[model samples]
Target chain A: MNELFQKVLAENSILLFCYLIGSITFILGLKMLSHPASARKGNLVAAAGMLIAILATIFLYRTENMSHLGNYAWIFGGLLVGGVIGTLAAKKVQMTAMPEMVSLFNGTGGACAMLISMVEFNKIMEHHPEEMHRGHLLIIVLGAVIGTVSFAGSMIAWGKLAGKIKDKTIPGAQIINFLLFAGIIGLSIALVAGFATTLPVFYAILTLAAIYGILFVMPIGGADMPVVISLLNSFTGVAAAFGGFLYDNPVMLTGGILVGSAGTILTILMCNAMNRSLKNVLLGSFGGAKPGAAGAAKEGGGTYKEISMNDTATLMAYASKVLIIPGYGLAVAQAQHTCHELEKVLEEKGVEVAYGIHPVAGRMPGHMNVLLAEADVLYEKLLEMEDANDQMSSTNVVLILGANDVVNPAAKDDPSSPIYGMPILEVEKAEHVIVNKRSMKPGYAGIENELFFRPKTSMLFGDAKKVLQELVTELKQM
Target chain B: MFQEFAAFFITNYRLITIVILSIFLGIEVISRVPSVLHTPLMSGANAIHGVVIIGAIIVMGSAEPNDFVALILGFLAVVLGTLNVVGGFVVTDRMLEMFGKKKPKK
Candidate 1:
């Protein structure tokens, strides 16, 4: 008995040591992520920490009174399959598809939390039917409900973002969604109240929760996808935290709490940037039909002045300072490299160049920054909206490349505009404004840009890449 | 019985305090990230939640062979937890790789 006790003590001490190292590295890794330069290393360090934690749990931490490790085959098989699929998917997914990928992965995490709780509850039902703790039951129910919702909701979000699923509201979607939510809460209460221990009732709660998840995301529009994704991401984290509570695992608990709070803060930041409240985003479902409706009214916009490539080149080359604003158009045209090339050539000609990035410039937050960074653009040259506006009046020329709504003066001047209260880059304040786009077509919000019609603004119409390449050639000739 | 309950409460109290503290710590750490790193930061956080695989492993290790439901759920949880961890970290590394100064040709 003393020998067995010694072995157990040794195993536990080693496990504890691993957990300590893992948790510390996780904290350090997150701290390092504050700066762009250290972010990659931070990720690797945290991954190492996870490796240690996983290994210790598998080999060192023994379950009480077990003769041998139970079912190593299942655990190793899962790790092998999941690792292969995840690595392949991560390697293959394009940066443009990142939002969907994040959503999909987050869904998997939620599914795991849900499954863990279900398994735990099943164990309790079989082995300890006569004894049930209210706290444990409550945590299990919370995990089940939240995890199911996040899983189903994230899948829907992924489908919608990938264009595999259309944004369609069922008749009376709001009412149905509310009813499903109520039913889930009611069922959860009943389960916690010890009404029954049968699997069917538990499964019923899961089904209702899953349906509620689908309903929760069904009405949200593409424009609000980032916020919805972030919100659901937080739900998964919170669900995982409940799992942590149930299992009494500190590392799991810490990880879940970190993700939950971070996702919540990000969601709030996204809402504030878009000038919408969280309630408005969840309940109003505001951006769904606006784009289509506004697209039909495109005929009423004033004609924008056009500019030749030669003129745009001449203006930019002669300018002392130029500011470039990029948006989804740049991403669509795959023009980031060409845009960077233009900046390089213009800089060689003694012109100062920089980029102005709007908070919601592209499909996702920080979309423009990533695209620009991929093209080897200097990080310091990427300015936030406020800072860009601060220097706009002094800028010799403003290049609006594939960007519209964020630079649209209507956001500030027209109170009737749908995006009136949203903050935008004040590109119209620059001395000479040049807008590059495929056509006079409005942006994703489907609203006309009054800045495009300003006397100081002239349009250089073409695909953003082609136009930028042409401008680069013209600048070279000069 | 009262002493046992008090001990349980004390243990839980420590955990609850830790949970609340970690929440604040999470927000504080992420708040320092610039908008430029938001995507990677978010993805990295997504990977951290994959830590729950430990819980899944524990459940599977403790479960009996006859506990089919528990076995299946535990297996599925392990797979999902692994996927989230691997995918999130790899994608984040790929993104962050894009940033920084380019190397000069030798």
Candidate 2:
């Protein structure tokens, strides 16, 4: 019986069957992930499929010599250590820190792809120097370059998001990036075509790719991070796909391709949400400089009005309908919970309160929704941009909470504005617009919001959390 | 170059077919997803690429006992890949947990 089991494990066909099953589960899991109802279970299903694939590979793999795989200790030990660290980090991370954490995790995946390419390349050089095929070599070089870039780029993005690294655009930065990219491609071709088959040349390609990755992300401003992260996510996927090509592994190919396409589609979706093309995002260092200085100076419509906290609380308390627009500032101030408290208080006063979520609000795609969800805001009450805009005119009070660019009328009225033509929440359509901000500073786009100067708008200046807390208290008294 | 690619494709037609089909399937499945689920779904897709851990294991298990470079790289690759898989899914699940049972008791 033991011999029969070993025989079954020795067959490559059974492993292929397992891989096919894993691939199918990944597709099904991703299919279920499109909706909120089954998203958690969908993640589990994909994870279970990954586990099956891992176990099957451990027991069933055999080489050309029909030698079964060895070194059980290293394999299981590595997995155990990684699994524990990953779980703890994921569990410990706060929702506000999620974007940075995701970048860190994605970077690790990129590193893994690069390392796998290196290991496989080393294997070829050591054991089968004469068996080099251009196709195989190309996969190796492509995987190494792309994986390294993804890893390095993600680390920079993670640093930027975590506030550890400031955006730096060196002089002639664009020229330097272009040349490095050219050099990487040139070196990659040399290695792939056997012009330089030495490991040193291969390593040079990776080094150049890594530098290119760092430079690629270094100049991008905060507003473009969602697009940058999404693009890197796709690069990592493509790198993993090359790994699958190297091994002829269906599960890897399917998962990699799925991620690749998903990331690509998402990158496009985010760019559309910002009313910018992918090319425009890459070339334009948006939110990096105060280019908005000119735009703001030109749009100096008038001085803005300020409302007292007591009056602000009374205004919302008396309003029949209130629409709250939350933004990246809200996330930075950790005011989602307090904002939700205000929402609930207003609701109890027989006032209608619903959140208007801009697709590109906060620091990431869907960032505002996640923060609100963490505060136990009902999903139904969170309206997308279009939905919120449709209801804007009927809204008695539009409360802009630590949000700016998404609500700026400049996006609609000023064609010369940097964010012009970008879809914004039509808070100006509401009967009254009350904005909660820390100060008169411009938003991430560095442009002064024209809405602030509108006659219907009143700025309530304070920290979002403190102000919301005070408003909640004031409402309770009424 | 064309001949090389032709030979490669002939040998890898099945895998190539799988790759092509999966790309379309991926785009189709999530084409209409609400923007609210973007972050979780992106993180979920990120975790799925951790399947490269299988390749890492293969390199580790198949290397000669004396090949320190291969073994070390493979070990690190496995560890990082595992982290991508485990952390990605776990974090994605946590995010989705909040989205569960939308009828908030509060």
Candidate 3:
């Protein structure tokens, strides 16, 4: 029996079993993740599969000569250090910073894939140059290129999201990006054709890819980050899938493909929600072009009315149904809790309150939902954009909380507007509209919200948290 | 030429089939996920790709003691891959936990 067990381990049968289990668990976990109730458990189930795969690899994985992989200290030490740092960062990150945090984590994944390609390339060159097949070279080159780009792009995205890096666009920037991408591809083809197999040539390809990645993301404005981040995420997944191909490992293959396709779908979904093509997002640099001169010119003569807090409170207090639309500003001011408090206060007054969440309301996709969830807002009260629009006609009051472009009439009515054709909240459909903002400044998209100048709309000027607090106080007294 | 291609396909049919099927399965499973769960779902998928840690471990284990570059690269890959795996899942769980916390009250 012991001999049979040894044989199984030596022949890699046990490792294969572990891989199969890991793959199955990954599929099941992802399927479970579709619904809210099982999403948490789904994550745990996937984590368990990863644990099994890792332990089995450490214990049972064998080299070509059937020797067990040595170097336990380095392996365990790396795992321990990384595990501790990762857990700490995840635990400490605030909800508002979640987009950057996801970018940072995804960047590390891309870096890991890049490093693996580098290590494997070195190993193949030094040990088995004769066995370097065309397929092997293709996988390595593709992995390195994609991995480096994803890594660099994600880091730039993280920086931009955290405000550490400013949006920078050079003269003829699109042409420059095109040239760099071409150079990387040109170098890769050279390597694959066996014309330039030297490390310097390969490294040159990587360097160009890194540059392209940086420049690719540097000029994208804040409003377009959801698409950029999602695209980078899929790039990382595809890079990892190349690693899976290199190793012919089932678990890695399935996981990588799963992420790649899912990320692709997510990117498309984000683009669809904004009603912009991915090409338009990349080329137009929709949000970063100096706030569109036309925006100022368009709203130049329009006047917006302001509402006092006393009247605002009274209006909401007596309203039959009030729909509250929250945006990045609400998260910036950390007013989700106060907003929820205001909701409760309004509810106590026998007023019906529901949150209208645009798909791209905050910095990232589904960002507003996470913020509201953190504030203990009941999930059912949060209505998506379409549902909110469906109820807009009957809503007695449409309260815009630190939100701007999402409710803009320009998206629908202004044909030449940069944000034209983008689906908005259609707050005009409601009987009354009140916008809360710091000032007349444009939103992240840098567009003047024409909705504010409409007859039924009135601006409530103040910080979202302060205004909400004052309104709560005013409502309680009423 | 056709015979050669067939031979190649016969050898790699399983992997090819897995790759193709997984793509369709991926699109099918999350086709109807509500927009609210998008963040957690994306984060969850990010964590899944951290399975690349297996590849990292394989390289690290198999490299010779004298191969410092390979060892170092392997070590870094392991660290980053672990970070991706651990961090991705933890952050996602944190987000999903918020979603789960208030459900019992409903």
Q: Please give the fraction of native interface contacts (Cα pairs under 8 Å between A and B) kept by each candidate.
A: 0.68, 0.78, 0.73
lDDT of 2 by residue, A1-478 (tens): 7986668555778888889889888888888888777788899999999999999899988766677789889999999999999999999999988888888888999999999999888877877978788899889889888899999999999999999999786888889999999999898888877788888988888899999999888888866887888889888888888889998877888889898998899889888888888887786556445664746564655799999989998899999999999988888899999988999999999999999999989878888888888899988899999999999999999988888988888898989877899988999889999999999888877777778888999999999899899999999999
Q: Which digits, one per residue and each the tens of the lDDT, describe model 3 over residues A1-478? A: 7996679666598788998899888888888887888999999999999899999999988777768899888999889988999999999999999988989989998999999999988887888887677667878899899999999999999998898998777778899999998999898988877789889998999999999999898888766877888888888888888888888888888988888888888888888887788987777566556456545656574898999999999999999999999998898888999999999999998999999999888877789989999999998899989999999999999999888988988898889777798888888999999999998888866666778888999989999999999999999999
TM-score of 1: 0.91
RMSD after Cα superposition, model 3: 2.5
Residue-level lDDT tens digits of model 1 in A233-270: 88888887887788787777887887898889888887
Which number leads on DockQ?
Answer: 2
> TM-scores, in order shown?
0.91, 0.95, 0.94
- The C-alpha RMSD in Å for every predicted model, in order, reads 3.2, 2.3, 2.5
Report residue A348 deviation for candidate 3 (angstroms): 2.6
Q: Can you list each candidate's DockQ?
A: 0.56, 0.75, 0.66
Ranking by DockQ: 2, 3, 1
Chain A TM-scores in order: 0.91, 0.95, 0.95
Any idea what lDDT model 3 has? 0.87
At residue A229, give the lDDT of candidate 3.
82
Query: If you superpose only chain B onto the true chain B, what TM-score does each candidate give?
Result: 0.82, 0.89, 0.90
